[model samples]
Target: MTWRASVLTIFPEMFPGPLGMSLAGKALAEDKWALEIIDIRDFALDKHRSVDDTPAGGGAGMVMRADIAAAAIDATKARTPAGTPLLYLSPRGTPLTQGRVREIAQGPGAILLCGRFEGIDERVLEARDIEDISIGDYVLSGGELGAMVLIDAAIRLLPGVAGNEGSLAEESFAEGLLEYPHYTRPREWEELAIPDVLLSGDHKKIAEWRRAEAEKLTRKRRPDLWAKYRKS
Candidate 1:
C-alpha cells in the first residue's frame, strides 16, 4: 500500500509547501506516497467558521475548539484507512526521533493534526488517541512546519526515495554516530591535503579511519548518543 499522509490544519495552503520540492516531491509525484490536506475550519459549526475559543481556565491566546478539531479528525479517519496513526504536533509532546520516523515510514501512513493558538483541547486528543510529538524544544507559530518536517523525514526513507541507499547507513543517528568527514578533488586546498587514508585505496584502513572519526565526533558533539552507542 502507498504511504499516505493526511494533515489537519487551519491553513491548507501551507502543506506540500516545501514538501513539493526535492526528494519528497519526487516521491510524491511517483505515487510512492499520497498527501491529503484537511482544513479544520471547514468543520467549524459557526457560520463564521471559528475553530478556536478562549481557554477554559483563561489563557492569553485561544485554544483550538475540541469539537471542531474532533470533527475534522473524525471526517479524515472515516475516509482514510483504518490503523493509520494520528499525530498532533505540540511543544509538550515527545521529542521526534529517527526511530519514530522509521516506524512511520514502515506503516501505511499517518494523520497529522497541526495545532495553532495555545493548542487543541486535551479532551479531544485523548478521545481520538492522537499521539503528540514535538520537533524540538523550540516553538513555532503553528504545527504546519512541524508536520512538513515529519513528513519529509519519513518520505525520504521510503523505498526508492533516496538516490543513494548506502549513504543512509552511515548518516548521523543511523548508526548512533555522526558521519565521517569527507574530502573531494582539489586534493590540496589552502595547504590542506585530503586525508591520506582516503587516497591510499586501502578499503579496510579507510573503513577503520571513518569509524574512528565518527566515534570521535560523536563523543565530542553528542555525548548522549555516544553513551548509547558504547552501551549497544
Candidate 2:
C-alpha cells in the first residue's frame, strides 16, 4: 500500500512545498506515497469563514475553534485508513524522535493537524486523542512547517523512496548516535587528507572507524543521546 500523509491546515498552499522537491518529490511522483491537503477554513460555518477567534480566557492571539477543528478532523478521519495516527504539531508536544519517525514511516501513514495563531482548541485534542509532536524546543510562526518537517522525515523512510536503503541505516539518529563524518573525491585537499583507515580499503577497519567516530561525535555534540546510547 502507498504511504499516505494528510495535512489539515488553514494555509493549504504551503503544503508539498519542500516536500515537492528532491527524493520526497520523486517518491510522490512515482506513487510511492500520497499527500492530501485539506484546508481547515473549508469547515468554517461563518459567512466570513473564520476558523479562529479570541481565546476564552483572553490570550494574545486567536485560538482555533474546537468545533471547526473537530469538524475537519472528523471528516478527514472518516477517509483515512484505520490505525493511522492523528498528530498535532505544537511546541509543548513530546519531542519528536527518530524512533517515533520510524514507527510512523512503517505505518500506513498519518493525519497531521497544523495549528495556527495561539493553537487549536485543547478540548478537540483531548476528545480526539490526537498525538502531539514537537520538532524541536524552539517555536515557529505556525505548525505548517513542523508538519512539513515530519512528513519529509517519514517520506524518506518509505521503501524505494531513498535509493540506497543501506545509507538510511547509517544516517544520523538511525542507531541512537549522530552519523560519522563523511568524505569523498580528492584524496588530499588544503593539507587535509582522507583518513588513512578509509584509504586502507579494509572494510572491517573502516566500519570500526565509522562506529568510533559516530560515538565520539555523539558524545561531544549530544551528551543526552550519548547517555542514552550508553544505557542501551
The C-alpha RMSD in Å for every predicted model, in order, reads: 1.0, 0.7
What's the TM-score of every candidate structure? 0.97, 0.98
lDDT of 2 by residue, 16-134 (tens): 89999999999999999999999999999989999998999675989999999999999999998899999999999999998999999999999999988988889999999999999
Instruction: Give the per-residue Cα lDDT of candidate 1 at 159.
Output: 83
Index of the highest-TM-score prediction: 2
Model 1, position 13, has a per-residue lDDT of 86
* Model 1 agreement with the true structure over 1-232: per-residue lDDT tens digits: 9999999999998879989998999889999999999999899998999999999977699999888999999999998888889999999999999999999999999999999999999999999989999999999999999999999999999989998988888888898788989989999999999999999999999999999999999999999999999999
| Deviation (Å) of 114 in candidate 2 | 0.3
User: Each candidate's lDDT (Cα)?
Assistant: 0.93, 0.95
